[model samples]
Target: MAALRQMQTEFNNVANRLVAQWRLEDGDAWAVIVAAAVAMLLWLTPHA
Candidate 1:
């Protein structure tokens, strides 16, 4: 449980950073959508 919690926290941090950086670089809503899509794909991909 603790490990899962840690992973979730780290994922959130990375997603937030990506969103912020992309938003700054693009200055548009598409940056946010792209960031979210990337994050979702990363999370959904199988890890084996």
Candidate 2:
């Protein structure tokens, strides 16, 4: 029982870390792409 609990804790920790990292990476990439697109649009559109 104790071993199973320990294994479960470890698994949960690993899963949390993976999820956090994946989210950070995905968010960063999306932000970069969106920023680049907005920059391009601003550059292309003329403002008086």
Candidate 3:
């Protein structure tokens, strides 16, 4: 339980720092996120 708590605290700190560092507006962020997801899907799809 103690190790789990420490892991959660570390994860939260990293997430908070990432949120603070990112500059994209909500719309731009969503667009980029969706585009990346689509690209990832395409890359993973098997081509015949």
Per lDDT, the best of the predicted structures is 1
lDDT of 3 by residue, 1-48 (tens): 676567557756654555455655656655655675577557646641
Candidate 3 RMSD to the correct structure: 9.0
Ranking by lDDT: 1, 2, 3
The lDDT per prediction is 0.68, 0.61, 0.58
Query: Order the candidates by TM-score, highest first — what do you get?
Result: 1, 3, 2
Question: Candidate 2's residue-wise lDDT over 1-48, tens digit each?
Answer: 676567557756665665566785887655655675577557645731
- Root-mean-square deviation per candidate: 4.4, 18.5, 9.0
| Residue pairs in clash, model 2 | none
Q: Lowest summed-lDDT stretch of 10 residues in model 3?
A: 39-48
Where does candidate 3 stray beyond 4 Å?
25-48
Per-residue CA lDDT of candidate 1, range 1-48, in tens? 677667767877876777677775655645665777687668756651
**lDDT of predicted model 2:** 0.61
lDDT of 3: 0.58
Tell me how candidate 1 scores on lDDT: 0.68
